[model samples]
Target: MATEKSGTVGKALGLLTLLGDYPEGATAGQIADAVGYPFSTAYRLLNTLVETGFAGYDRREKRYRLGLRIYQLGQKVAHHRGFEGAAVPILQRLTDLTGESSILAVLDDDRFLTVHKVDGPQFRTTTDPGDRGPLHTSALGKVLLACTDPATREHLLETIELTPRTEHSITDRAELRRQIDQVRRRGWAGQQEENDIGMAAVAVPVLSASDRLVAAVALAAPIFRADQEALQAHLPDLRRAAATLALELPLRA
Candidate 1:
């Protein structure tokens, strides 16, 4: 059912996501029924989205489809597939530089969404491109939380359960905050056997030219293959890759 939480903005974007399902496009009435909204409400919101260029109306077919603006913005985020072509090689190079798996993640709701991943020649991880990971346990998640604005960070910390994936995971919110604080200060984050036993990771935020947090990249490997010191040693390479990706992501300011 359509929700009231985000009011019009949320519903409108929800419509866009729903629209993605119909590549041939959908009529306003079809969209309204799918979302459980009144025809008039759906039509108005769809028109609004069309006017803003986030959606398009097919006059001949009397249908709505995703617009060019959506494609332009989608080309900057990995999961959108438009930017994956550019992101894949960068991740591959990072994996080569560190001799570990490289991960590219973006915020998905309150979790870290794995959008792109490159496995090292020596080892492979169970996590894949569409995996969603805990925000409190993985290095990618920490960098995302640490770099976000204070309000969002606090909201996530307060609301997200500190679910321990392994014995090393920080289940305590206070301790997690301290770790996040350290990550904020150091401009990077690390996790040891937190998300997975015998696995470790280190990450840095991919910031836009304007210094806005666009995404995060991480190098992950098993502890036997790369211990904490080994992981931290790759920080320089990770930062360099992130810096380079910042220019490539092309996020909206």
Candidate 2:
């Protein structure tokens, strides 16, 4: 029984790998061809994936895409830290001052997770503490990505396929590398609807006293409230707050 279970796990992993390679998704026949499994076996495995919430079938497209359950699992793993609670008051202050949603994000494996968020009283926003977004499309992700070593950044680029979340998303590796360089030089990052239409964000890196990158803070608002000029105007405040938080973080050494 144990051997049978292991074999089944291997087959499931192969199916998932095949699905991941095709972001638009694939039919059972395509997946079977890629995995070199019999069509009947592939069909059974696909059904199991859909039943277990690891994959979903789109009737319109007749293809299988990754399901929300995977995202929920990733989010669950990313929000395991208790330190996020400590950042709430600071996040609240940023929201109170800027009238935009303040977010605290931590870098996960090639992704960014919002660990804490304070919504502005003026308007309701979609982000929550466990919201997960891609590294290339988010202001918070850019700030954290910039703080990493160049080699690690390259590895991250090589591992994850960048998707165009919006027209402004930096999908090209070269452009993303250039943007990260600018973020490092400027000490902050800004995104104008890079991930969502009519939404904008600005981020600053929080570093430990030993200069290790710890986390990032971001302010998100609608385009009308967070235009390019407004994002630039708030840069100083965001940087100051990040610096203050950095000072409070425990030293790595």
Candidate 3:
């Protein structure tokens, strides 16, 4: 029994290494081949990972992928302070200035999680806090993706499988990478009728004092009301708000 347990641990470690090497993830057979392990052993380990929340499976493709648990563990270590407590007031100010709803979001696990949000008046439009959207489909998600380190970004893209939420959603990996580069160059990202038809959004990344990206701030409104001039006009305030949040975010040691 002891020998069997030791062998299992070794196999699990080998599986993790394979995943780390290939961020785009691997099939059961591919993982087995990568680790040079027996097919049955690799299959068992993959099944155990899915059962324990250490990996995810794509129902459509029938492939194994890394789960949110790895990201959750990283978040625990990366962000020790509560994000909402420090960022809510800043988001409120953005709403007060722009009259559009503001979202304070962090890249949670494998998805963007809204930690705080400030709603605008009845005339304004909004989405809910705690709403989860595809990274390739939302402005806030794009900014977060664009601002992070390149190696990590590539790793994330590998782990991510883009699902077309709408016709405007970026389904092509190369196109998404090109747009992300544009966001990095311009210091902001925008989505027009991408995730939701008739809705539009602009987002900028909040960087901590240590220069690590902490979250993204976004202003969302009806697409008809958010023309190019209006979006460009709001950019300064948006950038300022992100910078303000960055200043307030605790420097994780």
Candidate 4:
């Protein structure tokens, strides 16, 4: 039999899940109606969530939304599921198709952070879990930048140092912006020896059910084995894998 405390906890969690579905946030009355809880009980639970930082209440909007704390917890959950778990098979399949290394990356502040990687028989990439790279020099980063909001993208481009990783790296702000614009139009991004000499890569955005960009899946290879054209040729396969991964992985936002 469920105790009173356990029942309350269950209801609170159900309410939280419902709140997640509405990223724009909802009111206490809406949450109560959705969860079938009493108005008073729902209000108490929302206050608890806000105090704990699990949810935030906007004073001006008078709506409750998932807080930064929830985002932090989600990131930890994603990392736990990434290595040798949900993302492995997809990465392995990409590597198999391209005969190159494949990577899964998420936006980490102003940079792209690799979460998982699978190497093909022909070559292995240096990227690994916790490794971060600039958004202007790598295919995965470019896709992420392209999918971000215009204001946030501009802030990142202006603040983050665009150090030249190689002669091919785009250090000019206008040029990089144009490149990201192209990425948005093409639905994919590619780099030829930009992040590292002799390394070429192509990436596709992994979007959630709500069409929000959550992560990216990329194929990387040695320039000698696969140039930009070769990477572009494998985009169809990469996009398919990315689509599957988007459904499998939890939504970051």
TM-score of each: 0.72, 0.66, 0.65, 0.70
Question: Residue by residue across 82-198, what tens digits does model 1's lDDT show?
Answer: 445688899988887778999988765578877678888888886766677899989999999999878889999899988788989999989999999999999999988988998
Model 2: residue 52 alpha-carbon error in angstroms:
16
Total clashing pairs for each candidate: 0, 0, 1, 0
Which numbered prediction scores highest in TM-score against the true structure?
1
| Global fold similarity of model 2 (TM-score) | 0.66
Candidate 2's residue-wise lDDT over 1-253, tens digit each? 9999999889987898778787888998999898899999999988899888688787667898675557456556655653345677787888888888888777655788676788888776667766778988888999889987577677886777789987888889889889888999989888888888898888988887666787899888888876755877888788777887676644321
Q: Write the per-residue lDDT of candidate 3 for residues 48-120, one digit (tens) a residue.
A: 9888767877655667877656645644544445444567788888888998888877775457866577776
Alpha-carbon runs more than 4 Å astray in model 3: 1-84, 123-126, 251-253
Using TM-score as the yardstick, the better of models 1 and 4 is: 1
lDDT of every model, 2 decimals: 0.85, 0.79, 0.77, 0.85
Which pairs clash inside model 1?
A: none
TM-score, prediction 4? 0.70
* Best-first order by TM-score: 1, 4, 2, 3
Model 2 clash pairs? none
lDDT (0-100) at residue 46 of candidate 3?
A: 91
**lDDT (tens digit, per residue) of candidate 4 on 90-158:** 888878776888999987667887878888687778786667789899999999998876776788877
Candidate 3 overall lDDT versus native = 0.77
